[model samples]
Target: MSDAAGDRDTDRGRDRGRGGSAPFAPHEWQIAWRYMRARRREGGISVIVWYALVGIALAVGTLIVVMAVMVGFRAEFTDRILGAEGHARIYPIPVVQDDGRRVSAIDDYDALAERIAAVPGVIRAAPMIEAQVLVSRGSANSGAVVRGMRISDLQDLPYVAHPELSEGSLEDLTHGIALGEGVARELGAYVGDMITMILPGGQATPFGMAPKIKTFELVYVFRVGRADVDRSRVYMTFEAAQDYFNKGDTADQVEALMAHPDLLGSRANPTEADAALIRAAGHNRVLWTWKDANGAFLSALDVERAVMFMILSLVVVIAALNIISGLVMLVKNKGRDIGILRTMGLTQGAVMRIFFLCGAGIGTLGTAIGVGLGILFVIYIDPIFDVVNFLAGGGIWNPEIRMLTEFPAELRWQDVAASAGLALALSYGITLFPARRAARLDPVEALRYE
Candidate 1:
């Protein structure tokens, strides 16, 4: 009769494990759910459980939002940099004399540019001269980089050609120059005004050397959303630059655009496009991709991203530790129940699984809420910023400094998945110790007090 009674109890437990009208199911899940839900008399969830849920949700959501913004900023910055400069530039290796004098002109540059243009993946290659010169309008003087390129080639460049000039036209460029918007503003000059350019090289006279000075009409003004470029760069015709710099047929460098701009290299690794350009330019000449030129700045951005992620992850860790504490307290509170279940033939592994389910449920639910909220935030970030600015009664964003007038966010699925996975892993891991302790409880001792 005792054997029959034991068999009947075992069948009932198995039925409960199969999720047949059980409050939490499979048996372990049912028990976990019961612990989480408040009894009618209790009327509400435990404060600690609520804290764990809210904390995990907030941590995950914050991480997602911040990472999305960082990714967006990096993308925008990279695009602007690549747009201002081409994928790669092939320049002549400077010939240094034993006396330490450097010759900075590329020999047979026209022919070399032609060769580079013929290389696969190279869309357009043009000879250019870049020199540092002093620019003056009235009495105001600012140091600037003057880039001289063929008008036709300049027009072919999307970044240079597409800007809506606030002042004049490129068609009037003949012997005139185009100033960046910031430069125009600083010098208080406008289109049709004359600006003086002072080159370093000068003619040798009896009165020592006189700096070469020339004046050109400002034909155009452009803004590319980059402060450094807008404030410090001016463009002129290649012929005009050659005449002013006293270079006959040589160029300072060869700038090339690639068919696929995304394949451009980063600080850590060289891309196939860079390799092809190098091979085409030959070993004697120096090749610099946009990545090589901007590596330091890009590296700083990457480091900032990594550090931010690590710092934010601490929030998740703290929340997971809370899960451990909550589960440990739960094990103590349910000691009598665990003992009764063990006496009724439930396995130790089953007891462990019950607590695991509880913690995992909280993590999964919180992650879902966080991910949903994060994506919603990113989608509406611009409108939210607008509302904030309206309430603030002024523009909080400075385009000159921020390079963007609105908040940028890009929601990457991989980032979301990784964040969720991390939270879930921590939640599961922290439950193990408490769950094991509960499973190993002595049934007689636990029920004796009860």
Candidate 2:
């Protein structure tokens, strides 16, 4: 009889451990799970919990998508800017001529360029001559920046190579000029067509002033994607530019390429290549970095990114508040159970844990669903946009303004982790007050009301 009684007691303990029948046997988690699975008539989970879950899921998904787009835009703009310009440029301090007029032409630029090229982290250094010229084709005329570059240097640049030649070969570029797509369009010029270039600094003629005019065959038309570059830039051979501009053995600037272009800055934290260029060029010379050229624009992008994040985060906060409301109601509805559990020797901490688990379960499940949805949405974003555009009946993307047909999205794991952590923390934080209230409920009063 004694052995059978002991066996029966052991069986009952095992049942309670597995969350069968017993409400409390030092098994707070079992009670929590029961509470979550309970029906409305049986005092189980409430409808408000589902509402909180949906809210959190949507908020998390929206934040992820928005952040991804913002990152993509920044990356696209940065790449375009870096591709069009060298990492840094070293310009000679304007020299005062006998007439006291300042000229930007750098004398002995080859020796200086060689010195800059030898610097650590410096990939390559090239001397370039830039001049403003009037370009005319037939009746159309426009002001353009004529860049004189060596054939090898031009070929090496990513931006120059990025464009496909609609007509003619790069070899022909040596004998003539290469016009950007925008410039060609504006001037109504085409490959094999002759275009006239007039330099503003003219030679002294019998008359007042005669601008030096030269006609060259346009051998190539290239499109670098950027509208400004395409419209305003014209490329010519280094020697040809020098002769046309009346500048002999001199360049307007020395452009330096760095192994790490992002390190382009004016401060002491500059990369070894930048520091070497500054040291070699001396204080009298002006060194302009890509960052210096686009500081304000980049700063604006950073500010916009931060503002967007803050604004979108409000959605998550609101969703977290819903968790608080749902949990508070759960605590009220489960007061009788809390009283019984406490009377059965469940600690206050255990009571708190049960409610915490309930709220956290909603948060965790919602966040997981949201993250999955966000990833899928980002992956299929292009196709989704195309479908929407098709449904709308016309072109939603403006080719004139947007270079890309589909919106860009870049997903970073750090962003995902941060977002998940924030949501979880908020959910846990909001549950604390209600959980504490449930823990502190007096058994007698709770049972009296029940």
Candidate 3:
């Protein structure tokens, strides 16, 4: 080969070497990165970043803590209700009254009870009769709901029949009524005290008001903490309630206890499920789930949590706005560099990607930092909660009575996934407009201005 050809080849090798190192050399990414670094070095921008970070941190931390608190209360209360009441209850729509005027007796109740007990998830099904009446003890008066239950049937459901009996023995329920804590307090009656009960629909005798107004001695007192329940529950023998309430040879309804309470209402159509159970029991009766009984309260809690999440999410939105401002400023500051790049060979799309990455970088970093901080706070929430309680004028740590006495936090993985996903989406969304504008810049005009 000629010397001239060799010289040309040498020039081509040098060019290839330079091009190979071009990616590592100072480029648009480096320029954008340097701008970011410079902003950090500058006290004003650094302070803004810190402020944004703090805002994001507090918002996420408080949201997680508050949500956990709400969940804690809901869970605690629901569990208590489950323990005191069965997962589902079956009852007659219109309670069979004793007019003694040709009433239809439920001869199939025994078979029904057995069938309900045979339901897939049901552990036990028992006949139940509930009567509401006014109880008086020498001028002291209180309204109470007397529940008649067979001791053998009740022994199967321990959550209700034997829940932390404060002062009464289960055996006493067989002979005499067991008074709830509030009922005992209101009637000014105690164990061994005789109380007269007046059934609301008692048959008035010729002697005036004599539908078996029997005086039953209180044998036990139970404290269940729930205001509504603690004030009214009284347990009597099934036969006793049947005789007094004229519920002869028939129960008011039947109650079923399930293995999985949460899955009680999960059936697409509960009528079908109940029908299956009734068929299994060889009786046709209506079944009511805990959801049917307490839907309003549960829905209120769900709405409250959703509102709190939306309200708290605004804090993060505002912090995300700060990222927008930071990126816009970076784009403006790097306008000349972008113009030069466009003059060379960088496509408008590539320019857009550069700005997009920067914004996304901000979001990614911020979200990561925020999540780490949130988890840390959750881990040490007990101590922080104590500090807050102390500040609120409780010595050392007064248990928080709003939901629970102690700080209870359950960090749902789904919540973490949702929060981080939202942050990324918002970050990317915030980038689009500014990135497009930066990419569409008139290189000639920008370079001329520079």
Please tell me which predicted candidate would have the highest lDDT against the true structure.
Answer: 1
Q: For residues 1-450, write the lDDT of model 1, one tens digit per residue.
A: 685465456656765775544433366777788888856543333666777888899889988999999988888777777777677888777889899979889868888889899988888999999999999998999899999998888887665777634578887888699998888999999999999999865555688877899999999898776777888989999988888887777899999988787687854587777677778888678777877877787778789988898898899989877777777778888899998997876766677788888778887887788888888888899888799888999668776787653466888999888788888888888878888888777778899978
lDDT of 2 by residue, 1-450 (tens): 685465456545655674664443346677778777758574434667887899889988888888888887677767766676678899988878999988887787888889888887778889999988999998999889999988877877776766634556667877899888888989998899999999865666777667889999999888766666777889999999898888888899998888888766765346565666889886668788888877777788789888988887888989988888877877888888888876675656677788888888889988888888888888898888789988999578763475432377889888778778878888888888888888778778899967
lDDT of 3 by residue, 250-330 (tens): 887778887877766623346555556546644345567887777678779889988988987887788777767777766
TM-score of each: 0.85, 0.86, 0.75
Off by over 4 Å in 1: 1-28, 39-45, 95-102, 164-166, 203-206, 261-272, 343-345, 385-407
Off by over 4 Å in 2: 1-27, 38-46, 164-167, 201-203, 267-273, 388-406
Clash tally, candidates in order: 2, 0, 2
What RMSD, rounded to one decimal, does every model reach? 4.5, 6.3, 7.0
lDDT of 3: 0.71
lDDT of 3 at 383: 86
RMSD of 3: 7.0
